[model samples]
Target: MNFNLLHEIVLGFMVVLLLVAVAVIIERFIYYSYIERSRKRLLGLLAKGDEQAVLKETKGSSCPHARLIGGMLALKGLEKDAFESKVQALYLTQQAGVKRLLWMVDTTITLSPLLGLLGTILGIIDTFNALASQGVSDPQAVSQGIGTALFATAAGIGIAVVCLVFHNYFSERVERINEQLKVMALDQAGAVAGEGSGVRGGREPARIQPQAAAA
Candidate 1:
């Protein structure tokens, strides 16, 4: 393939697109890794029965899921409903953070193919113009034009494919983390409720039962 043909097909913008795609991939890898590590640490703390310690540790970590769990843990002594509310609020905030930049990923995937198609059209038009100007007498000129046009289309489709794969992979990871968070919240709530009832080893007296329990 001629270097000029490759350049024409890529429309000078392919490099920029590739760089952006690579940056996205790297950013996602780092983000997910951080979240995963934070989650494991938080869960380990929870398993060890150090809920307060987990909350304090996560408060300084800036991890979204950790923050949510911290919020739930902070309400350990609150009523069940209040605790649930705080957990839900924190969960929402964490989810919003997790979803950040998702739209940009989607846009990048969508735009890549369109840009490729535009390059293809431009390449083909330039080739046809050359043919017309040269009276279509030279087969070499015609072949060059067609090659450039096709190259642009191929590059665009290739970029789009990469972006789409990344988008799907990252989206799945986000969903998995979100599900885990929901489970954690419910478990924390159950633990809090149990502790409040005198079901645990602690001998703290249970709160007054409802009037119906006395009847």
Candidate 2:
């Protein structure tokens, strides 16, 4: 194999993977920021039965949580079973949205180390080839191959480590958002059902208390 081309290819791929991972990290952070900011207020509006208010808050928002809450609000007046069913469907849809682009990060995590290992192998091969041809008379060739091997190995490991941290963080964020959506749906459903029949699950439906958005 042409070690030079192979080295470049490995390095180029690693760079691309790192860039993609970083982009995902930034995008998810921004999205989570929006979701966290609007959560309390939107739930409060739902609790108050202020459809107009909730609509206004969710206006133009792309957050799955926002859209999920808005969808739930529109499904008001449904019977308990029907309401729960619809909410569940909406929940699954929104959950899918929340998971968007996450697979790329996962790909980065899995591919980086393998690419690095390939580079390392290529580098060692080049070193042996250089020494065999030149009998150690050409120090530069041997050093060049070793350098390629080390750089490729390091870059691959570094990218994987960074992406792994973010992957876990984003995964946890998804879980938390999922939990929040479940609570909001349950509360909104209970409140609506309670209004119709004055009870839910053998008791008054839980209400979402209003709170100020985090600073």
Candidate 3:
């Protein structure tokens, strides 16, 4: 087998992985942007404290944050333990949507470097084969072959690094969004409880401000 051909194959695989990673990144960005816009609208409704409006938006909306908050609102005034359990269950159910496409990015991150190394090895083997078949009278040819072989490793590492950075960024955003949902749910729940009990003398309603939840 031609070592150059093998090297090209490795690089080709790396390119595919990179493209996958980039696609995932772009998709996640669009998804998260939509989530952000939906969240802002929901927060605006929440700030108005119009129960009907909030319920209407939540009912018609597709955002997980909206649905999560809506579920919490629907379950308001329940016992703390039961409320928390239901909220947690809701969060777990919605997690699949929030984490979509992230696995592809992760797969690219894990495979890029290994594929690169494989390409490099194939290149080096080819180089040695050439030396065996023909005397190494031209030292420059050996050096060039070795250098070309290393491109596979470099390409692999480059792809992995790019994927790693985006993966971490998306992961962090997921964490922040998750935490925001949880906290906002709890805050709204508390606010509802406060309104129901008529205990306005002590603590104020902790309606989570939308601005505070910015990711």
Candidate 4:
């Protein structure tokens, strides 16, 4: 087996995986920044039923939290059940978006070491086969084969470690963001519900006053 080409392909794949992980990291950083910036202010607007301001502010955002605010704002006068249903639908969409590209990280983490192990085995096999054919003519040949096997083993483990750390970091970050958005949606919905209750309670006194006057 031609181990040089095999090693080259494996290294090239690891390079691509590294680039993809970097992209995911940067994307999450931007997304998290946008979400954090808008959260408090947008929720405040939802509480006040200031739909216009919320819409205007959140118009250009791609963050998932902004969409939750939008969901809450859209249901400004809604009953609690209706509010929850809409918010839940939007929440799932945000969860899906947050999880994008994570599969690639997992795949890279899984494949890197397997490929390295394969390369290691092949390197050792080729070395021994050469010794059988050429009678172990050069001491350097033994050293070169051992070096190849060790390098392949190291490369695989290294890729697995790097990808695993990054995957965990990004996945945990997404989970936190998802939970925060869920809380924000429910809080805003509860506020609207409370406001609705207050309005109904205040009208009851007037309703009774008019009936008493008629009687």
Candidate 5:
């Protein structure tokens, strides 16, 4: 097979991955932002400390933070172990959700440059082959190889950088959300404990009234 052909194939594959990475990055960014907003809203509601209002506001919410709060509210005199278990479960669920499509993004970041390098090597080989067969008589033939090689390298570098930036941004955002969740869980756990010792007395947690539950 011709080195030129192989090089083009590798470049083609790199282009495909770049396209997929762009799509995934945009999707993940939007989804994560949505989750963050929902979490923030839940936290804002949680801060009010009105048991009925929290449940009412969070009713039908799908945010992991809201779910965690819900679990906390549900437990009246239950052991801390049960609440801890819920916390762990919520963390795992949030982690899994945040990581959706991250592997593809990471793979593109790692593979793009390697593919570009492979293409560059093949381009060099093609240039040499052209020079030998055509006796350096055709400068255009050699130049074409060099151009293709450089093009692939530039494209790969560009793709990799974008992916890396996106991955880092997402990682930071996930960490922030998780931290907020942990803090809220601890605070609410304490509140639940304190209230458990109050007049509520191990009864069912306060529920949102349907009339006020409309979001």
Candidate 6:
């Protein structure tokens, strides 16, 4: 019934938590709205061996995964070692981008419980202080302190739960995409190498003819 105590318990932490939550929601929306579609298009282009099309599709986009695929395509004629190196570099870059903002989600999950514990400690301290001043015989005053203390713990756990769920789901999606990328890279590499070998084998070295003596 006492909102003042609830406000005191939630206070600044609630605002911070709300902001973090909003950020996560926005990130998720962007991922699904734009990044997800781009990924599907990238995969399709890779499957069709349309490197130019893939590059064009991702040229203006900031998606890391798309950039990785494009980078590999750019090295199409390079030797195996060079191509692999380029691909690996691009893969690492894309991985980092995919994992961006994940740390914040992790931090929220880690901090939520601690914040709740802090609230609980403060509530207990307040309750004991009240008891000392007003006497232990007053149950109503004691209840107020205990109730306020529990609010922090509840909020912390709730925030952590939400963050954990999102983190796990996003992580799984990323893993699946990474797997697909790996497979596509291997297949493309083999196809390109085979073509290069066939061309080299069919070609003959140039022969030089002696020049006729000048008068």
Q: What is the TM-score of each candidate against the true structure?
A: 0.79, 0.84, 0.81, 0.78, 0.79, 0.77
Q: Residues 96-200, candidate 2, lDDT per residue (tens digit)? A: 777789999999989998999898888788778767777988778678769868888888888889899999999999888877776665555665543642212
lDDT of 6 at 143: 89
Model 6: how far residue 107 lies from native, Å: 1.2
Ranking by lDDT: 3, 2, 5, 1, 4, 6
- Model 1 score (lDDT): 0.68
Per-candidate clashes come to 0, 0, 0, 0, 0, 0
Q: List model 4 lDDT by residue over 1-215, tens digit each.
A: 67656766766776776687668667766766677777766656655656577677668677777776665566667665665566666667787777777888788788878878877777777677777888868979788887977787788789789878978988788777867765655455554444443111011111112222120
TM accuracy, model 3: 0.81
TM-score, structure 2 vs. true: 0.84
Which candidate comes out best when scored by TM-score? Answer: 2
lDDT of 5 at 184: 60
How far in Å is the alpha carbon of 45 misplaced in model 3?
A: 0.2
TM-score of 5: 0.79
Error of 4 at 26 (Å): 3.0
Candidate 3, superposed: residue stretches over 4 Å from native: 73-81, 190-215
Clashing pairs for model 5 are none
Q: Residue pairs in steric clash, candidate 4?
A: none
Candidate 6: misplaced stretches above 4 Å? 1-11, 46-51, 191-215
Compared with the true structure, what per-residue lDDT tens digits does model 1 show for residues 1-215? 34346445456677687787788788878988999998888777766776557757678776776776666556667776666566666666777777677676687677777777777777777776666667778888788778867777787788778888988999899888877766665555565554532112122332322221121
Residues 42-147, model 6: lDDT tens digits: 7676556565676687686776556655565566687766666666665556666666777788888898788787777777776776677679797886887688
Q: Give the poorly placed runs of model 4, Cα more than 4 Å off.
A: 40-50, 77-80, 191-215
Clashing pairs in 3: none
Worst 10 residues of 2 by lDDT: 206-215
**Clashing residue pairs, backbone N/CA/C < 3 A, model 1:** none
Global lDDT of model 3: 0.78
Each model's C-alpha lDDT?
0.68, 0.74, 0.78, 0.67, 0.71, 0.64
Please give the distance, in angstroms, between residue 135's alpha carbon in candidate 1 and its true position after superposition.
1.5
Candidate 6, position 212, lDDT: 14
